[model samples]
Target: MTLRAYPVRYLPGEDELVWTGGLGVTVRFTPGVEPLTMADEVDLLVVTPEDFSESLQPLVEHKDSYGVATRLVTLEDVYGGVFFEVRGRDEAERVKYFIKDAVEEWGVRYVMLVGGRNGGLLEEKWWCPVRYAHLDDGSNWEASYLSDLYFADIYNPDGSFSSWDTNGNDLFAEYSLMSKDILDLYPDVYVGRLACRNSYEVEVMVDKIITYETTAHGSEWFHRMVAVGGDSAPRAGDPWYEGEEENKAALSYMDDFEEVTLWTSDGSLSGPQDVIDAVSRGCGFLFFDGHGNPMNWATHPPHDEETWIDGLGVGDMRKLSNDGMYPVCVVGGCHNGQFNVSLLNLLKIYEGYQHWYSYIYKGEVSPESWAWWITRMAGGGAIASLGYTGLDWFATGDGDQDGIPDCTQYLSGFMHVNFFWEYGENGRRMLGELHGETVADYINAFFPTTEKLDYKTAEEWALLGDPSLMVGGYP
Candidate 1:
């Protein structure tokens, strides 16, 4: 099949150009504060009139599918070649807008561009300054509702610095000073700096240093920063899944679980309400497997809008104020667990959603690994609550027969077992561990009348598993 391409060319000294239908136009610009290195590959899409309809169909159809704005470019017959300027803005934004506009305007479909110097557009908007500061006072503050703030002092380790403004005052000035220091140390870090209105702080200095890489200029660096750390929520089965042997092995492990419900689909949760109803019916754990984006729920295209409470704002998906009792929700897809504080601000406006465990993966992930993780978790393994492994298993053909495709497999084998195990084990472990009762005592402790388990507090119940597991609560 012929693929469409978006070609972005840089022309030095020329403001614009005139192009016939067949000739390519040049875009004049430079790399922002941080130059695009060999590591940073710019994606280009080129589209012509022939494929315009085909190129735009999916985007137009899925407009609010992910809840974020998607950009499209339609290039007119430039009576004169258009000027793609990247002056004044920071490097990152400059490049981003230039490329974004190019694709949106010129009907580009395929992306191929030379890396480094004299070829691609140089833009300024991409640069943002990085700041480091030690708060004068030891109080901690929330920088922004949905944004993440990194706090650390150059000198201290344990208690050296904090990001609190005890007086409820904005800490923009203080933040700017620290940012200036970061800029001074790494001039190419960002195009410029801005003070944070909220005084959010990071407790660990090591974490602060690492966060700077994310806020830096290049896309490669930003993606790398987001991919770092053991922050990803765990999956159910073993980390490796081959053919039926692996599948049978994984399934055998799941025999200990009392109940199991497996939901499979391409990448959307078409029956979230049914699952919710089951959870409300006292199903303990809920597992979802499929393709997922960072800020929205993954469902099949032509989403069932009726399921979402109209006009309800968002914080957590569970807090949508549905009549059913919320089960422990687990998303086994890529990026579902990931949350940005900035995005949270958007959710808080809605009433029905509140804070729930949203374990996120940073990049592309496969359904097979998800399947393995789920099965293992269902069988009583402790892998589901720790670490992120983004897209590492795609090359392995771990679970699926055809290998895992990039399309969101949101509800396939990945979501089935994990949800089953989590819900089944919920209240039982609580009384046994929290009350210090023997396994026999705990077994006998179940109420004969209701067959229900009781716990004194949520925290005590939540501490049933190894305290070290990072993702979900213990119980």
Candidate 2:
């Protein structure tokens, strides 16, 4: 009676054993002996680099205290084949395979990726590597952008791995006029990220999550939802202020929360100063409907003059004094969620700006995106933020061809406003549930692959935060 571990594979003549136990065995041997398994039954799985393992323990404990049944697995653990066999073309796919295994064995509902680049603003290294989707919307000159959705959409419809590499060319989610890879955009599990470069940032986030869950319930500030916008797309023949209309639609679902409108039509959204003042005061949630880049989030006024009314920037993060009262910010704009921005790209300026050059790579801008700056703010900022990692598009006129106007659709507005709809109307309290369900709902309604813009829309939208967060705190 000895024990040994072997990679599960199909035997040439042996039939696969079918069982209803806590394991998925591909083959069985050794009569009268049960196999060992990692069947701990996890509700939330935290994946991070070994360096941040100690820093994330508090978050693990806090989640457990709230009956979440959390588990923390390091990159080293998965790569070393401690719990699952290593497989995939790259590290990103390997991590995704681990997620699939977790779902099948431990029944994980939420996953939190807890690491980012390893060095300072100038020097960088990916601790937890990300997958870049090559879904070209024809307008995206860069052709690729970081997407965490690949990790969440673990399985395809028929229980096969949703590798996002359908064409088998190793180009994941590649979509062009000539080459295309069909994908099951629906998420098998909800996922989020903490893009922390160091342990201090990890500590900051852990404390924020713990405090928010333990103390945020029934707070008056938590009852107020702040909606800020102007003219997101000031187009002729379109409405004078489309952003305000979008915000109003989002506010319609959140009827219980106090509506704090700071729109340009009301003379409230004049500049960044107004936004800073409001954020400093704090609120339960913040919806910023406008145009944005990695450096800043801004929009035009009520008319179609195209005058930019600045809302927030990475530099203004220090002015936030709301402290523990962080809102889950949903910014509707382009590149606000582009977490792949690197300061090291500044050195490449010697190469003249070409087709691949994105404006976000400017040397003067912050290395991190606006939404990340908000989430990583030491004391006052957002607990989480959802936005597009690339060029976000709104429906010009019934892009879906559903007969009804496109503005009435879900992703056409703030896009993530469906997150609010999930929470307010559907009663999805967990942050990731709202986030994942929003994506799933979009996929269900749009049947994505039909339009390139639709496919890019779902792929680029990303959530940056803990996925298992209890919305409005644990009451």
Candidate 3:
């Protein structure tokens, strides 16, 4: 299956293009200081939209006070010279070049995309870069999905471009999205997106981050983890049923916890009300493992012969008044964190080649999509989230053919390791570091073993909140 590119005139609703849609800037980047340099290795870089640049100061300062090194810069600084020059080049590619330079020159560890994405209209606004990732190597129509993993996987180990285009097509990040040789697979650097639409949304997120880190609210609640499990394999007796997400949730939450409250699809905890109530009541962290779509988290109950429950959606999440008490929700489900690209783009690229459209077209654009809505809610939602951007694969998550329960799904395992292993084992208390550690841990596990690199399944997931937000220990 080949990705067919159309000329500008051939595309429909040309005005709705999000990429290359930012306003032109006349001035190029002139740091004024001779050759830019940072005395210490850079740990975090905040790329804010020009409009919301100043408002991010407090957040950056907060990150600094924690002894975590960070720098905040506007898109203009990187793009330099008139808006048209920035427009002339693909913003995503240009941004990647900047990141590549930072990685090589400044010893940068993490990059944060500070704005949100708008699905309705693709007018000039904050940038939300998109990448084309392959699901499998074969002629799989569904193989090519929209992703932002391209930005994360910058180079190959051989010093050549892994380019996601293993076939060496001019189209870099396409089918066979990431090459195992791309050490970035372990992700040399971590990335996160704040997903804020405006300065107000930015305010809401920053407030949550600062308060969650500084205030002495219920210190007692910080250790309380609410683990919600979803559907088990359609048929219980089967060894492997859709990756055993429900089972993973229980063990993952209990992985390092002795006092945490673990909720499952059991009759009492699987209902929509139960999940919402749990989130509303607030907890140190939240976990959900089950089937998911952009619109909602749906699961089939193991009980009744054929009964299912309608799980919570982003709209339902917005309805929650968790006050200032927010939990870092780590969801092990598909499309749980599909921030920028959506089902529509998924369909457009694979439209003629696949028959999956009917089942895949469940979500629309930005404001309505699941990931951005929850993380950017006006009052309370997750301060940060670690979830999937596209369909999550379960079969090979634990090496494709391992025994049931013994095997781990790609994302499920990542979250489990992040909280259980990475937290104290690696000493990463910041969300950004935890996220990077999570992916790195997963890569370390699968790497060196000769296991085929399955970047799509894991790379599809990402951090949907502020990268610098602290994980557990508070200041």
Candidates in order have lDDT scores of 0.23, 0.79, 0.59
TM-scores, each model vs. reference: 0.24, 0.87, 0.75
Candidate 1 residue-wise lDDT, 339-425, digit = tens: 211222333223333322221232111212222222122212112221111211111222233343211111122222322223233
Query: Who wins the TM-score comparison?
Result: 2
Candidate 2 TM-score over all chains jointly: 0.87
- The stretch of ten residues in a row with the least summed lDDT in candidate 3 is 6-15
Q: Mind giving the per-residue lDDT tens digits that candidate 3 earns over 70-93?
A: 777677777883322343236666
In model 3, what is the error at residue 43, expressed in angstroms?
3.0
What is the Cα-based TM-score of model 3? 0.75
Question: Once all C-alphas are superposed, what RMSD does model 3 give against the true structure?
Answer: 12.2
Model 3: CA > 4 A from native: 1-41, 81-89, 119-126, 136-141, 158-170, 176-184, 216-218, 239-265, 303-305, 341-361, 396-419, 447-453
| Model 2 worst lDDT run, 10 consecutive residues | 9-18
| lDDT (10s digit) by residue, model 2, range 1-475 | 2223323321111223222334543655453354324466899999999999998988888899889999999999999999999998888989999998998899899999987765444344688878889977767346888889999998676567898988799888998878888789888889999988889889999999898898889988888888888876666676536677777778889988988888887789888788878888879899988788888888887665658888888887788898989899999888888886766666555556751264434312457887887998788999999988888787433443445334545354635567778888988889998988888777765562356777777888888999999978997
